[model samples]
Target: MQRVKAVICYDGTHFSGWQVQPGKRTVQQEMERALTRIHKGEHTPVVSSGRTDSSVHALGQVIHFDTTLAVPEDRWPKALNQLLAPDVQVMETSFVDSSFHARFDAVEKTYRYRVHLTKERDIFRRHYVYFYPYPVRVEDMKQAAPYLTGTHDFSSFCSSRTDVTDMVRTVHEITVEEDGDELHFTFRGSGFLYNMVRIMAGTLLEVGKGLRRPEDMPAVVEAKNRESAGNTAPGHALYLVEVRYE
Candidate 1:
């Protein structure tokens, strides 16, 4: 058997999420169905680097699957794209070592949350960006973001329903930038808990609105309570930007 790694990108507007669910349409379900059809009667499961929540898009999501058939790596992308939906496309494919596991081998993940801060939202970009009519002070958001960079117990930023026991994770970087009327929040971390990025974005938005002091980040983090943090931003604004492996 040979292991093949596929890089995928999806719009995520029509699917429930990335994982396969029993009665719901999903990215993994579509990919697995396509693989089953390509392999004729054989069925293969595609393992993704991570699970993205509903309405969250991906730009460089990676997955790996083992197959018995010997197909040229270069043809994988074209063949899969032909079978996959227009919103989901296989960007690239390569032969990987048999021992390489997509989820286990992943070392880092980056996500970007986009917000359009203006009186009127752009009709063309409405599906991708969250529209907030209030004025956002980008400098205030940047000043508050550095406190979240580094290893910390992020229970306050995570969803209350998250079952993960360990809340400590390393945030390599957190950047807030403005492009015209759009505000971008980019976070690079070793791993993330459920709703962590969205909550962080919401907290940063509070700081930008002068509702939260920049110096309060440490205290808020130490609180380790979800209620101490701001509301979770919409999942549609979040994108799985990239995944890195060693």
Candidate 2:
């Protein structure tokens, strides 16, 4: 058997998520189904770098699967693309060392949340961005972002439904950039809990709207309670920008 790694990009608008679920359309399900067809009806298991929530798109999601067939690496993309849905595309594929793992070997992840701030929605960006047609205090949000940097227990910013007990995570950086009515929030971190980026976006939005002060960030982190944080932002505005492996 040979271990194959693939880089995939998908518009998650039509997917239930990345993982396979019974009676649902998903990125992984489609990929595995394509593989099954290639293997003459035998199910092939595929593993992803991480799970992304519904409506959350991906620009550089990585996945791996072991196959016995001797297909050329370059042909993998063409083969899979022919069978995958229009929204899911296999961008690249290659043979990798058997020891490599998509999830366990990942060193860092980057996520981005996009917000379009215009009274008149842009038809082009409506499907990809969250539209908030209100005034935003960008400076306040910038100031609050620093407090969230560094290692901390992020229980307040994580989904209460998360099953993991360890909520501590190291945030390498948080960048807030604006271009006219568009705002991009980039988060680079070692790892993130379920809905962590969305919650962070929501908290920062609250800071921008003057509902929460920048100074409250440290206290919010200290509180470690889900109720102490702001609302969970919509999933459609979030994207898995990249995953880094050492």
Candidate 3:
């Protein structure tokens, strides 16, 4: 069997997320179905670097699968694109070592969350950005971002339902920037807990709005209580920007 790695991009507006559910339509389900057809009814399982939540999009989600078919590596992108829906596309593909597991071998991942701070929301970008009418100080958000970097127990920002025992993870970087009425929060990390990024964004938004002090990040993290953090931001505004591997 040969292993194949593919770069995928998708607009997550209509699907139930990246993973397959019992009856829900999902990105993984669609890709697996397309692969089954391409492999002539052979069931092939595609493993993703991470499973994005419902309504969260992706620009460069990586996935891998093993197959016995002899299709050229260069043909995988075009072939898969032909079978996938317009919203989901296969950007590129390559043959990789059999030991390269998409999830296990991933070294880092980056995600960006966008917020539209305006009185009136843009109809075109409503599906991709979270709209907040309240005023936000982008500089304040930037000032608080550095506190999130480095290894820490992110239990306060993680969803309560997360089953992972260790809440510690290294955040390589956290950047906050603004362009016109759009605010972007980019986070690069070794790994993330369930709803961790969304919670962090929400907490930062509070700081930007002057509702929370920038110095409170340390207290929030040290509390290790989910209630210490702010509400979870909408998943629509979050995008899995990229995944890195060594």
Candidate 3: which stretches are off by over 4 Å?
none
Q: Over the stretch 34-113, how does candidate 2's per-residue lDDT look in tens digits?
A: 99998889899999999998899999999999998989988999988888879989899989999989999889999999
Q: Sort by TM-score, best first: what order?
A: 3, 1, 2
Question: RMSD per prediction, one decimal?
Answer: 1.0, 1.1, 0.8
TM-scores for every candidate against the unseen true structure: 0.97, 0.97, 0.98
Give Cα-based local distance difference scores for all models: 0.91, 0.92, 0.94
Q: What TM-score does prediction 2 earn?
A: 0.97
lDDT of 1: 0.91
**Model 2 CA deviation exceeding 4 Å by range:** none
- Please give me the total number of clashing residue pairs in predicted model 3: 0
In model 3, where is the ten-residue run with the lowest total lDDT? 135-144
Tens-place lDDT digits, model 3, residues 1-246: 999999999999998999999999899999999999999999989999999999999999999999898999999999889999898999999999999999999999999999999999799998999999998888888889998888998999899886799999999999998877898999999999999999999999999999998888889889989999999999999999999999
